[model samples]
Target: MSVLLNLREAHPALHTHPTPVLPPWPRVVVLPANRSPYGLDLPLDGTATVAVRPYVTAHEQRERRRELALATLGLDTPGPYWIHGLEVA
Candidate 1:
């Protein structure tokens, strides 16, 4: 087990189940659209996982994520959106 995982097991008061890190491959579908969203078929094998909650205390660490997320064209934030998903084999 990783040291972080061990730490979580040791301190229930300070830690919790982390997020599942999805395998970088086996794509997870993200529906990004305003006019009738479409489904994306991910290639996931369904075994990979990521942390459930944050393991870090700094917000700066996540800044890169936000920036990368906004890199796509024609994407604007702070908008009305609805999302629902289903998974199948």
Candidate 2:
């Protein structure tokens, strides 16, 4: 069985974005400044259906696995992701 990974709360500001139509669900993750877009680049889809809870919240930053965050925002949850950057590994 695919076990859901644990996630830690983080600052939303860290998720520097370029404006997106969020579906009030999926959590947004910001990639580092030095990384370019290529892998883990998911665009926001208007017709997404997923209840996104707070993967991480402000003042609650903690270490998390990369795969877990991906699953939460990837196909599993939705908001169109509304993300602009990738999470750390």
Candidate 3:
């Protein structure tokens, strides 16, 4: 079983708005299961999915925006990015 949490609703300050539009290849941040305060008693064997819309770096945002603009003008957009399965140990 997998547990999912919306960090934005849980800790708004940590996930402030104006969420950046990520590029085809974006950075990922992972938090360990033991670090969560709310899941102290939960089984460590299960997996947890931390859904977060992270803020991208300014440069990344600019690049993504530029791609969007080109797309709006009927130009070729960037290639797709895949989200492989998440692992919990």
Find the candidate with the highest TM-score and give its number: 3
Candidate 2, residue 35: Cα displacement in angstroms equals 44
* Candidate RMSDs in order: 35.3, 42.1, 37.0
TM-score of each model, in listed order: 0.17, 0.15, 0.27
- Compared with the true structure, all predictions reach lDDT values of 0.55, 0.49, 0.59
For model 2, where is the 10-residue window of minimal lDDT? 1-10
Q: Write the per-residue lDDT of candidate 3 for residues 1-89, one digit (tens) a residue.
A: 12335655667677566868976876687867566666667565534665445565667677767766776797854466222333212
Which residue window of length 10 is worst by lDDT in model 3? 80-89
When sorted by lDDT, best at the front, the candidate numbers are 3, 1, 2
Candidate 3 vs. truth: CA RMSD?
Answer: 37.0
> Per-residue lDDT tens digits of candidate 1, residues 1-89?
69989888888877556779986787688986655245445555656865444646356446535644664554545544322232211
**How would you encode candidate 2's per-residue C-alpha lDDT over 1-89 as one tens digit per residue?**
12322221334455567777767876788876764457545666757866545765422333234434766876344333223365332
Residue 16 error, candidate 2, Å: 87
Candidate number achieving the greatest lDDT relative to the actual structure: 3
